[model samples]
Target: MKVRTDAKRDEILEIARGVFLELGYERASMAEISTRVGGSKATLYGYFPSKDALFLAIVNRLAEQYVLPATERLEQSLDEDPRVALQRFGEQFLTFISDAEAVAAYRVVVSEAAHSDIGESFYESGPKRTVESVARYLEGAMDRKHLRRADPAIAAQHLLALLAHGEPWHQYFLRKAPSPTRAQIKRIVERALDVFLNGYKS
Candidate 1:
């Protein structure tokens, strides 16, 4: 039996990501990925049980790479002004989701959601975890009297919603607009923080 190494697993993930992006979730098959990886279907299956599982793994990886760092910064900056901390996190969060890979994965998940549980799985693996992390930070802020007392989870959702509002990424997701520039993201985050702090400041 061959030893499963992290390098090999990463290679498989990279290849699978490309396949999914090029062919989409419904059209991309394990067989095709296996062929592309220069490996047998059994070997590929050993790493990822199904297409849904593979796709979820990709989402999880992306979240770890992008979302986790932003949330970590939010946690670390707890001593800073709420507006400053949130502005930094909001900018990073918007930038990550607006990425081409993230946008493509979102398209796949939305398209496959009605047909299977991939959407739920994707949410569980990625968005849900990020939300929980943000909620924890918000809860800490509330405890410190930096923000008003409220349901942290709901507050986190509201803050994130505000951050995403009217961004070009929403239209880009629908192929109607281009990816937002850094200037646009900075403007959006500042506006969002202004409104959020106005409502929630303690």
Candidate 2:
């Protein structure tokens, strides 16, 4: 058994991310990733076990780096207006998911979902985790009477659905629309929050 370090693991993840972006999920292979990492296939497998595992790790890293902190910021607003915290989260979520590269990655995941488990891996690592984080915040809001008591999971899904709507989201997924401007994103989020809070407020 070869010893592994955080440095080597990070190196593998960076290289794998590049390969996945360039060749996409279906075409990006572990052997190719190993070559780019300047390591033997055995070593790369020792670190990640399989291509799916490597891909999931990359997804997890990206989600944690870009998405988790935004949702976390909501916790600090417990004493403030719930609308403020929800708006911040909605904006951040929309912006992150609408990035060009992020859209491309999602397309790749969706394209390969029927043939591979990458879709499940992606949902578990990224979207599911994010929803759970949001649900926790919503649960807290309900407990404090900042929002009405209800099923936090269902409420979380409804809030995300509202934020994820609009022509920008649909067209971007089709690879035909540009990223939403900051002002556009703010408007969308504000409107979504308005609808959500109105329906959920005690």
Candidate 3:
């Protein structure tokens, strides 16, 4: 099957993402995706050279869908007061975890992480970047006297660990019970900031 150059790579990737979510990393076969996308395994290979390549493409697609939009939301609303910005940040970050793709990716990564470096790489690219972004924001806020002085990176990791509730988000990815509510996320962020500021006030 000849795929036109004009064929929407993103459209294919989105379909592929749903496939990954449903079947996970090892179980998700290329033939399954080929059928869904109206292409043969050969055509799929033309677009993605191997299973790892397909997974990587899907990971990049999910990052665009799940990460970039959330980042934009935070940046666009970042001009508000520090407290409100923090609240918005919590809301936006929570939004990512609530996503099916994000959840599925975490499950896939955690289940396979002990066996595959790919999973580790994915986490580094996605989760690690998020933590660092939050740290950078906190650090900048401190520089401007908007937030109290401290290790912003520590504060950043703290915010996430609280959101995770003592479990690395892998617990949620594993279908753990008692998924949090919006109010819970908001409350935790408020309390985290309170504790963080109390420790940092000079």
Candidate 4:
């Protein structure tokens, strides 16, 4: 039996990410992933019990590397002005999700959601946690009177939606348009913040 190690787990994840991107979730097979990783299917099962579990792990790993840090930093910015704090968070959020790898993962999740629970699993593992984190920050802002009283959870959803709307990123996600420039990201974030603050500012 192959002894499981973090290195092996990471190798599996990295290889599986490529397979999923290349073939999408439905078409990508555990056998293909095992073959790519140079391991038996039993060895792959030892690391990840199922394909859904493996996919969620990849998504969670990406979230931990990027999204979680940005949300955690939101706490550090609590003393700053609401606009400043939100602008920083929005820009970081947009930049990460607009990344090619991240977009590819989203595409996989969306495509597979109708047929399986992978979409719900992905949301529960990554997006739901992000929404909850942002909601906590917004709750604090409301208490500090920087923002008007409202449902922080709903506000967080609205802010995320606004940030995601219209952009080279949105265009890219829909039609394989070119990757967004930094200037385009900054402009998009600024516009999102403008609309968010106008509605929520105290």
Q: Which stretches of candidate 4 lie over 4 Å from their true place?
A: 166-170
lDDT of all predictions, in order shown?
0.88, 0.85, 0.69, 0.88
Pairs that collide in candidate 1 are none
Clashes of each: 0, 0, 0, 0
* Each prediction's RMSD to truth: 1.3, 1.7, 3.2, 1.6
TM-score of each: 0.95, 0.91, 0.78, 0.93
Q: lDDT of model 3 at residue 36? A: 91
Which of candidates 1 and 3 reaches a greater TM-score? 1
RMSD of 2: 1.7
lDDT of 1 by residue, 22-62 (tens): 99877899999999999999999999999989988988998
Best first by TM-score, ranked: 1, 4, 2, 3
Q: What is the overall TM-score of model 3 with all chains considered together? A: 0.78
Candidate 4 lDDT for residue 19: 95
